[model samples]
Target: MVSSSQPLASLIGRKILDQGGNAADAAVAVAAALAVTEPCSTGIGGDAFCLFYDAKSKTVKALNASGRCPEALTIEKLRSLGFEGDSVPNTSAHSVTVPGAAAGWVDTVDLFGSKRLSLAQILEPATELAERGFPVSELTAQFWKRGEQRIMNASPNGHEMLRHGKAAPAAGEIMKLPNMGKTFRALAEQGKAGFYEGRIAESIVKTLGDLGSTMTLDDLKNHSSTPVEPISIVYNDQLRVHECPPNGQGITALIALGILDSLQSKGKRAFLDAGVNSVSYLHTVIEALRLAFADSKFFVTDPEKVHVPVNELLSKEYLAKRAELIDPQNTKAVAHGSPANSSDTVYFSVVDKEGNACSFINSNYEGFGSAIVPEGCGFVLQNRGSNFNLDPNHPNALAPLKRPYHTIIPAMVTRMDGSLHISYGVMGGFMQPQGHVQVLLNMHHFGMTPQEALDTPRICIMPEEEGRSVVLVEEGIRPGVVEGLKALGHEIQVVTGLMRANFGRGQIIVRREDEESAGGHVLVAGCDPRCDGIAVAQF
Candidate 1:
């Protein structure tokens, strides 16, 4: 089964699986295809993360393929550029980090891919999609249209992404990216060096440099993917939820789940027994997440650059202490506890017939990234560095060769018996972990199917002045629940008509292992209705 934000990309993943590729290969193919189909959200110029479940070992492994800042770029440089702010401007060239997705793609294949398929073969489908062109999906077209001005005015080579160098492509219009195809072919033929060393690397460095960015070819050459042990927390004693470690914010989901578990242990049933989407249920989940965010936002940074107390934060004792702060009937002001913590982008799930699963996410921070297309590279440079805080004392503050806080994450859930249960993720800046918590509980506690879990009305806790939170409830949520939340002193905003994308787009593939089932496993998948995507199963 393959599920992703773009239907054509999902088909490419399915094709890879049929062609004797494993989940890792299918995932990379989908990642590349999405780069062609959904250029507004992801590309080679961005970053990617993967959580792969190796069926044979029954262990989840993580790959942090996010890029680092240019070694010469600094807060002082931005200050000298006459910008005095807590963070770099969203579209500034200085915000362009080393593009990690290209190397990340090659690394995932090299590390977890089936040896049967060559890199060139795995990427050929996406390369073809880019060269031959495809009709633009409706939602993708809307997002592309929204970013048109940004690409045109802010990007030097922005005309490359535009239709005829002027307007955004309308839905159903065939859009071709021959330049991106050339980039893909270069990668296929030369592997990692094809992207990071030769013509493509020179183009990226020269383009950003002309825009006053300090990025150099060496930054691209030095980039490599880091594989780490995935961090997870046992949920409901039945399953374990896995996420990438700090600098990626996957820990935020674990911390939130841990807090909820602590609440359940303390006799808080409203979080579960009140039924899904009820005022009590939503309120409790929201409050727990708020507390989790309090911790994650304070502690989640590059662990290599700072000490992140991952063990202490996920410890049962600390979670119990944090759960004590939650009010069943109302919201509360929460702060970072000593224990510690923690989007944009594309999230997809792939599960091969052999039970190997890959939960993957890739992204360019914000739409079209910094909106700066690298000369002939046919992709936007990710403004991931825009996530960095300018306060010199902050742990996530911009520093030479350091990764800023990353929003894109991939997730997986495994049963206690060490079998893959679900491969999934929710993609959107800040809404990611929150979506993970809601969707997981929808299935684990309420017994909803994968589709039901994704279709349910979602709520996002948007930050407001003075640390207050305004809950953005999707349109389908009952009106009484909205009023009930407001009465509890929670600020409420009902989102509808296109603005709801802020809540996020998610994908899920649930694995049911049964000796009697076909191939001893049944794969059920769901794609987000909020975007242009689908879930397909291959026999």
Candidate 2:
């Protein structure tokens, strides 16, 4: 089974599976396809992270393929450019980093794919779609138009991504990106060296250099993916959830889960008050997430630079201490409990018949990224560096060769016996981790199916200064719940129409241990209807 935010992308993954590819191969296919069909959110000029569960080894491995700041990019330079202290403009060339998606795709396929399938085979579907156009989906067209009107038009040569050499293609309008297909063909013939070392790499360097950037070809060539141990926490002793370490925000979901479990174990009945949509459950989880984000803001960064006390933060002693701050009756902002821890784009899950699963996420960050599509290169560069702070004293402050705080993450859940249960992720700017915690609890604790968990209304707490919070709630949420949350002191914005898509587009695959049939374990999956996504199986 394969799922993604674009139907053709998901179909491409299912196609790879039908061709006998493993989950890893299917992942590469789907990610590549999304870059073609959903260019507003993802592309070759981006970054990726994935969680791969090797069922044979009964272990999950994490890959961090996020790119780093340009070797010449520095806080002093950004400060001089008037981007003082977390004020980096999203449109600035400095906001663009060395893209890692191409390299990440190669690394994942090399590490986990079968010998039967090569990178060319994996990327075939995407290349075909890019060569011959595909119709734009509604949500994608909306974002595409937003970029064309707001950012791309002002950017030098950014309009190249627009259809007909003009505005963004409207929904259902067929658009072709032949240059991207050429780039993919190059990758097919030359592998990682194609993207990081040759024409594509040269285009990336010249694109940035011509636009007042300090980037060099060495910065692009130096980028490589890593095989890292996935950090995990046993949640409620019923299942274990895993996330990538710092530099990505996966740890926030784990922290929120730890806090929720600690609260319930202490006889806090608010969680059990009602179903997934209940006010009590919503408020409690939101507050717990508040605490999680506080610590995440204080400590989450690229651990390669500063020491991040991950073990100390995930310790039961520290979590229980953090849970003590939540008040069941009255809701208020929670403080960091002295424990430190831990989008746009496509978030998809692929599970093969062999039981291996890959939870993957790819993004250009902040809606069309830097909006700097190089001439004839056929993709946009990521504004991921805008996530960095300009404060020289800050851990996530801009620096040469440093990765900024990232928002894209892939998540997986395993049963107590170490069997994979769920491979999932949600894609949006900051709504990702909040979406993760809510969807997880809905399935495990509230007994919702994969579809129900994703379909449920979501609420995100927009962090303001101390003692204040702004919560964005989907319009489908009950009116009484809105009043109740407002009464609890949250300033609410009820989002509707296209605006509510900000909650995130998610995909989930649940490998039911109890479900067995002629096909073996039943792979239940669902995709967010909020976007043009789907879930499919070859069985």
Candidate 3:
């Protein structure tokens, strides 16, 4: 088994596997290391969800470690302060949510790890780098330059980091955060308690309060992570699914799969070719998302407080009803639904020699999160609070200790024979659900390799708009395909080079029927690629 992403993270995963760690153990190690090296995309301040496939048990399990809104956050309080519940400011102190990453990382390792590493052992690399600093990547530097001014105005600490009066740091410049180092150290030494109940919590509360934020120590102390059952749909005798219940949009992926399944069963192979059928399939997928998303927006709130009849959501009847809304020959205009959640997230997957596999996704809503870097902490706090509607009547309205609608989702695919097929995830805000569906169709229906499937062109329907949309056709898609799609009444947008942002960064590990595992990286898709990521296989 191995890891993907930067060469360093890939090397770490291989090292863990070399040291006899199972897939879960190797994933944990790679995840922890990536939290530091890929800070622009993810960190400990975010939340995580994982799907695991255990070959021995022939069972799949899901771990939901998403963050919750501060318990003190209530509609009455926001109203008292003249804040509109439906229009909560994006960067306000009130937008901060209780961080769930620390708990998630620890819990995942505890539950599935065999050769478990201590928190310090897991976090040592990140802590050292945060303390000493590392050179910024060119992409990160570009975001930094564009975002510096806005970040500075976000919070006082933000200004300190961006050095408000100065220019943004260049690509090779050292980016350091001693405060984040201290926070990681505390977490390493004390685990979850260090971040949730002790001095670390105290500091977070104080810093938030100082910035006129509403989060309190009680919010941190009372936070807990819950496990939820995953949802699945059978397509071509294969199970395609993701975690269900509370704060995740995995259902969106299921809905897309169901739609594809219907199209395929109807012998609609014409859509498999790069032409009108492709555009038609995209339109149907988007329409399905629009309808399903409406329910998610209205009914999918904190599961502990709201009884979401998940069975109803995933039932064949429910999916069938939703499917009936799709038009086989036409495109539908869709709107960007009310913002469920928006964050800069990352995804990674792993499969080991033991036939064990894991698919994980993590995020800090928006880049640098709330941009509220507590003194001595290298990481930014999550602004998951932005996911809550200010409208008191909405199920996802801001309530004391409620979890906002989360976007991070991890997915798994298995053959009908109970053989694990793929552990994968796509990283983007609302684009995640759409990406999941597209990739699945690319693999199962179109019969493309994982790399080719991920590398294919993609289209995203505006969540709230009905007919208007943005479609990204990768350079590889045939020109005739684009013309055919445009003829189908889609507002096509062409992107130069690769279509990274419009699509997503997809990483996957596939365990073939022979029990041989392979992995692939999302970036560098055009280069010489292999299935097992940067992993060295061992028999």
Candidate 4:
């Protein structure tokens, strides 16, 4: 089963599966297509993380294709320039992180795929669509209109590609990206080397330099994708949680789960009480995130440069100690020490008939990704650079060839029997971990279907600096629960007509205890209702 936010994209995955590809193959194909069709959320310029579960081995492997800072970038240099702020300078040059999506695709395919498609073959649809153009989706058009100034100021090439020398393209306008076509062509012929070391790299370096950015060819050439072991925690007798490692706050999700596990083990299942547990769990997790993110801010640099105790963070003793901070009845207003820049990202999942699975999350930071289209590359550069702190003393401070604190995280859950249980993810900067915990609770605690869990009203506790903590609720949340939450001191914000799609865009695939496979697309899947994304099965 393949699930995506777009039905057409889902159909593409189903088509690949029908053609005899496994979950990983189909997911890669659909993701490639989505890069072209859903450029507002993700593209070749972004970074990706994935967890692939292999049925034959009953083991899961993680791929971290997160981008890296340029070799010339350093905390001292950034501080010396006096560009201190929570936000990164929004320009093509400053926005560009070493892109890892293409490399991720290559690595995933090389490691697990059977009938390998050349980069050209896999990306041919995107290239053709880029050249011939496709209608701008309503979502993309909205973001373009709202962010036109930044798009224009990001880079000359960006202005040319996004606006065709005019203002930002309107909704339904035929948008073409000939440069992306050229980049795809080179990748198809030369593989990753084409993008990292050849003309594509040269174009990126020159464009960034021209825009006063510090990226160099060496930074491009030295980028690599690492396979890391996922962090796991036990939730109950049957369920186990897994997430990407540091630089990403996926551990926040684990922390939340651990807290919930403690509550459930005590036989506390009151629905409203469970809601209280949910909030409390989030509170503790946020505190842990505060500490972990403090480390992320100051110490979680590239694994090559810093020593990260991956095991210690996920240890039971640490989690138990963290969970002890939860107050079952009170809502605490936590402080947001620093804000990570938000990104427009996408998440999708695939589960094959044989039960192999892949949960993938990819992002380009903000919408249109710093809007810096490299001349002749056909894609916007990612503003993941904004994730770095400008402060010289910060752990996540800009450093030569270092990985920034990341937000995109792919999630997986397995049964004790070693079978794939679920593949899922939520997009949004800080909200990702919060969303993941909510969905997991809805499923594991409430026994909801994947769709029911994802479609349910969601709440995100914004960084406390926003002062009043606002919980944006979807249309269907229990009114009494809202009242109860309000009574508990949450500043209630009733969002009419979907306040945030990120709260609901999660996609999931589940393997039931009986060995049946099921899949779900969130309510936002109907953003383009006319498209076809029905989940299918083959016996």
Candidate 5:
């Protein structure tokens, strides 16, 4: 089964699977295809992260494919350019980082792919689509059109992203990215060096330099993806949930789940019996997540640059302490617990016939990413550097050659014996972990299927802005539950229609390997109704 927000991209991934490629190969294929079909979320100019389950070994491995800031770009450089306040401009050339996606793709294949397929073979489907063009979907077109003016004004070479050098084409219009196709073809023929050391790298340097950026060719060449052990927590002693380590927000889900487990242990909680949309269940989860975000924001940074105490934060005793802060009857802003733990993005998963599953996510930070495109590159340079904290005392402080705190994370669930059970993720700026926890609980505790899990009305605890925070809920949530949450201290906003995109667009595929369904596995797939996406399964 292969599922993505874009139909053509999903079809491309399934094509790779049909050709005898493993899940890892199909993952790269899907990601590359989505780059062509959904430019508003990801590109070769961005970064990626993955959680891969090796069916042969019953082990889960993680890859942190995110990039770091340039060696010469520092807080002082921004200040010298008259930049003010505690943040950098999202649209500035300075916000661009050395992209890690292309290098990451090669590494994923090297480590997990089968010898039956080469990088060129894996990428052929996407390369064809980018060269020949595909019709834009309604939701993606709406998203793309919103960024047309921003891309034009902020990027020196942004004129290339337009239709006839005017506005973006509407939904159903065929859009061809010949330059992106050219770049993909180069990667296919020459491998990683095609992206890191040759024409692609030169375009990166020349374009950024023209826009007053400090990025250089060497910075592009030096970037490499790291293989890391995935971190997980056994939830309710029945299932284990996995996420990548720091520099990404995967831990936010673990921390929130840890707290919920603690609360459930206290009887102090109903677990899930309060009804799916009950005010009590919603309040409990929201408050726990708010607390988790507080800690995640305060502590998560590049592990190479800072020490994030993952063990101490996810510790049962520590999580229990954090859970103790939640008042089941009411809601309020919760503060961070001692340095504990832990966007415009795309999330997709593929489970091959052999049970090897790849849960992957890639992103260009925010919309159209710095709104900057390299000359003739047909992709946006990510503004991930804008995530760095300007405070010198902060752990995520802006520095040379260091990664900023990341928000994109992919999640997976495995049975006690280490078999892959669920591969899932939710994509939005900060709604990811919130989606992870809710969808997970909806399935595990409430017995909802994958579709029901995603269809449930969601809630997001917005980051604290100037010490004021609000909880945004979808309109379909029962009116009584909304009133009850407001009755508690929550300053609630009910988002409706297209605005509900703030919640997120997610995908999931569940695998069943029980005796009743032996020999062949049953693939239950679900795609987010909020976006123009579908899940495709092939037995």
Candidate 6:
């Protein structure tokens, strides 16, 4: 079974499965296809992360395929450029980082893929889709329209992404990305070297250099994806929730879940009894997430460059302590606790017949990221480097060859016995972890099916600004619930119509063991209504 934010991408993945490829291979195919059909959000010129469940080993592993700052980029350079601020401008060339999605795709296959399919075979489907052209879906076209101004203003080659160098494509308009297809063919034939060591790499350096960036060819040539240990906190002992460790914010969901469970176990709040979306349930969830974000904002950074106390943060003792702060009646001003510390895009899950699951996310951070397109590459450079802070003493401060705090993450859940349970993720900038917690709980605590879990309304705690707490409440929640939140002194911004995209586009595929079937497993999946996507199963 395969589920993704783009319909064609999902079908392409299922086709890989039909060709006898494993979950890892199918995931690569989907990632490539999304880049072609949804260019405003993802492409080879971005970063990717994956959590792969190796059923044979009964273990889940993480792939941190994020790229780093150029070796010459530093706070001093930005200061000299006359900008004095906490973060670089989102679309500036200075914000572009080494693209990692290309390397990430190849590495994921090499590590977990079945040997039955070659790299060329795994990528061929996406390449064909790009070359032959495909109609733009409604949601994808909306996002593409949002990127029009950036693409036209940020790079000389940006016009390639627009219709005849003038406008964004409308829904149902057929779009062809031949240059992207050529890039894929290069990758298929030469592997990682095809992207990092040739014309593509040169074009990347030239594009950035032309815009006053310090990036060089060596930055791209030296790039490689990292394989790290997957982190998790067993949720109420019913299931283990896994995410890629620090630098990605997946830990935020685990921490929030831990706090809620601690509250329930302490007999302070009966969450299930509170009922989904009730005042008690909503208040408790908002407070716990506030506390979780406080800690995450301070502690999540590149682990290779600084210490992130993962174990101390997720400790039951710490979670219980944090749980003590939530009041049943009001919102609280939250700050990072002492105990620890730890985008536009496509999130998809693929579970093969063998029960090996791959939960993957890829993004060009903040649509049309950096908006700097390499000549002939047909993709935008990611503005991921904009995530870095300017405070020299901070762990996430900008520096040479260091990664910034990353927002894109993939997640997986497993039964206590270590069997694959769910492969899922939500795609949006800061809304990801919040979406993760909400969807997982809908299924775990409220007994919602895969589709119901996604259909439920959600709330997002916008990044704190000027010490104010603002929450974006999706429209589906009852007005009484909104009033209940506002009565609690929480600043509520009701989001409706097209603006609700802020909630996220999520996908899920659950592996259910069925005693009645000879194969013994049934795949159940769902795609978010917010996206033009679908979930497909192979017969």
Superposed Cα deviation of residue 174, candidate 6 (Å): 0.5
Q: After superposition, how far is residue 299 of candidate 1 from its true place, in Å?
A: 0.7
Residues 280-349, model 3: lDDT tens digits: 5555655666666666666667787667666787676667676666665666653435323232677777
Between candidates 3 and 6, name the one with more favorable lDDT: 6
Write down the worst ten-residue block by lDDT for model 5: 334-343
Over the stretch 34-107, how does candidate 6's per-residue lDDT look in tens digits? 99999888989999999999998899999999999999988988998986888898878888888999999999
lDDT of 1: 0.88
Expressed as tens digits, the lDDT of each residue in 1-539 for candidate 1 is 99999999999999999999999999999999999999999998899999999999998999999999899988888898897878888878888889889989999999999988999999999999999999999999999999999999876788889887788999999999888999999999999999999999999888888889998888888888899888989988888889999898888889889999988887777658778999888888888888888787778788888888999999999999988888776777665422111135899999998889999999987878898898898888889888888989888888999988888888999999898999999998888999999999988888889999999989988764565767889999999989989988899989897788888899999998679986887888888888899998898
After superposition, the stretches of candidate 5 with alpha carbons farther than 4 Å from their true spots are: 336-343, 516-520
Candidate 2: lDDT over CA atoms?
0.85
Q: Give the least accurate 10-residue stretch of model 4, judged by summed lDDT.
A: 523-532
For model 4, residues 45-88, the per-residue Cα lDDT tens digits are 88988899998899988999988988777767666667667546
List the lowest-lDDT window of 10 residues for candidate 6: 334-343
State candidate 4's TM-score: 0.88
Give the per-residue Cα lDDT of candidate 4 at 442: 73
Give the C-alpha miss distance for residue 421 in model 3, angstroms.
0.9
Per-residue lDDT of candidate 2, residues 1-539 (tens digit)? 98888889988998998888999999999988999888889988999999999999999998999998999888887667666546478878888988989999999998988767889999988999999999999888988887786545545666568797788999999999888898899888898888888788888888888877898889988888888889989988889999999988788888889998888788786566676667787888888888888777767788898777889878888999989988766777656322111136779999998999999999988778888877677888898888787878877778899888888989999998999999999888678888899899889877899998999889887866566777888888999988887777778889898877778889999998653586557889989878888899877
Q: Write down the TM-score of every candidate.
A: 0.98, 0.96, 0.88, 0.88, 0.97, 0.98
Estimate every model's Cα lDDT from 0 to 1.
0.88, 0.85, 0.67, 0.69, 0.86, 0.89
TM-score, candidate 2, is 0.96
